[model samples]
Target: MAANILTDPGLMPELRRVDHGFFGPDSVAWRVWTHPSILIGLQRAVAVQFLNPFFTAAHDDAQAIYKYPGHFYDMTLGFLLSGILGDSRTALQTSDFIMRIHTRATGIEPISGRRYHANNPETQLFTHIDGWQSMLKCYEVFGPGPLSPADDHRFWNECATAAELFTCKPDDIPRSRDGVREYYATLRPQLCVTEAALSGMRQLLATSGPNSTAKLAAFSRFATPATLITLPSWMRRLIGFDQPAAVDRAYLPFMRGLLGTLNKSKRATRTTVRLAAPISGRILRQHWAAGTPRRAEVATVAEARKLYRQELRDENGFSSDTEYTAAH
Candidate 1:
């Protein structure tokens, strides 16, 4: 995939543009992603990054990050793999687990809120699972081989219960929200395995084939808009939502500068093809390689303990007697 991306004359320019946007000086996305304090601030920024489109659709950042040209790659590749590799069972299971996490993480009842949050992680996970089931159904209809029993029961059950909860219209429990806030405030921890799993998934899919690359590019594009829409409302308020002009004035110059660099590089006669392609490819490959699979990686709970122990060993670090809270 790296080799193809590097050698493809047509893709190099666009890929270069993407790299510039992600890594260049004007990159708000890069700035937030690489911040040292990846806590409330970064989380809020990320949420805003994903949700900018629904609230404000006038800018290039919204389009670039959320809705670009290639957007169906991941679903397509997943489907392709299931058809060819006979691993739909595994993919379905994996999708189910991720969907459950999404449900819990987003605090949304998956089945009832399915339509409104169709692009939400939880809904998307279910969609992926449904796709797998549909594939099984297709196999039953067309193929001579025996079809696998549908694994939809558990998912359906959960979704149904979630829908019932939604129908019940539970009263707004202020105390519950307060408790959640307190819990998160004390547990300043990152889900290391989740990060690792996503990373590994990307790497595995990237190395799969040219089709996989296309799938990834497509999936990212399609998923970007939903990400923007589902971002917390608070983030929009923080970024001077009322002062659109000011926000643009503060940020657009950087974007323009980066875009200019990309445009210049594309037109440069001396620019070698090999160098252009590999720069972004290397960065992406390294990122994916670092990610661990969900099944293989240590739990976040365990990783937090290890981090605490390392911190304790430092002379300037908090003393053993000092209490520490998990910071997500």
Candidate 2:
């Protein structure tokens, strides 16, 4: 098969990063990512991170392939998956690699008159928090269904623990959906999407669909419009995703309905989730074949996705309950 070159390693790794953390298979974060509509929150989290101007300044527009939305799905999933599922040693390596990369991500924010470093704990905290919030948003709206407020509180607490790897203190993070709402209340004063940020956004969106042929890539491109519908009015305005309010209102229901129906099938949804990489690879190949003329090399998506699926299966095993938790 075309994906075998990437999955040539015969067996899955035995160790896991979350074996001792609250984010273990029993956690809500696990439940959120394994859901049929996992991609929904994952994409939204990427968009939400850019709402912070300092974070936005870190994206280099010239590196369209790297900064492109087509690539966002894998990159984001890798970050979370490494921390959430990789062995402790691998997880630490991944964290350190990111910190080292961010060390060079220092820049001046023209609008805020502030210097920003991707490694900055507070900045990283904003990203961690936003991601947790987005995960919950997608799971509630697209996955199995809405979780209880009490469960939401427990989920947020667990998320904070996992996110502590990024420097979030337990108290500094929200503990419930309402707390997330309040957390955003505080950030309203500090957040604004500037033209430079908007340009960075454009770089991402412009490459959204044309860059890959993987079904997941196509799904991501399709989700872009619906994800935009979910973005806060302020965030949408910042990036200039100006569809009429009526359009957004119409999109939300249709997307929710589509994803909900898919959630009804355990086999189909799991297959889609597991195929993220091959889908991404197919997307890339399609782009090259269709006159996109790739300028640089991207590590094989099939291989990356193969490893991810192996780890996920090893951790959770094959369970029927779509909401089934991996035995810790």
Candidates' C-alpha lDDT = 0.27, 0.57
TM-score of each: 0.20, 0.71
Q: Per-residue lDDT for 162-220 in model 1, tens only?
A: 22111121121112223324533342231112232333223322223333345444433
Query: Model 1, residue 240: what's the lDDT?
Result: 26
List runs of model 1 lying over 4 Å from the truth: 1-71, 74-122, 145-328
Model 2: how far residue 99 lies from native, Å:
2.4
lDDT (tens digit, per residue) of candidate 2 on 1-328? 1111112222123223123222443566656655555566766776677678777777652343354454455555655655554444334434444444455567787776788777677787788888777777777765556897777877887776666456446678877777888988988888777776666554444333455555644565677777776677877876786678787778878878877776676555545555664332332222123221122221222333334444443332323333122111
- Cα-based RMSD of the predictions, in order? 20.8, 12.3
Model 1 clash count equals 18
Q: lDDT of candidate 1 vs native?
A: 0.27
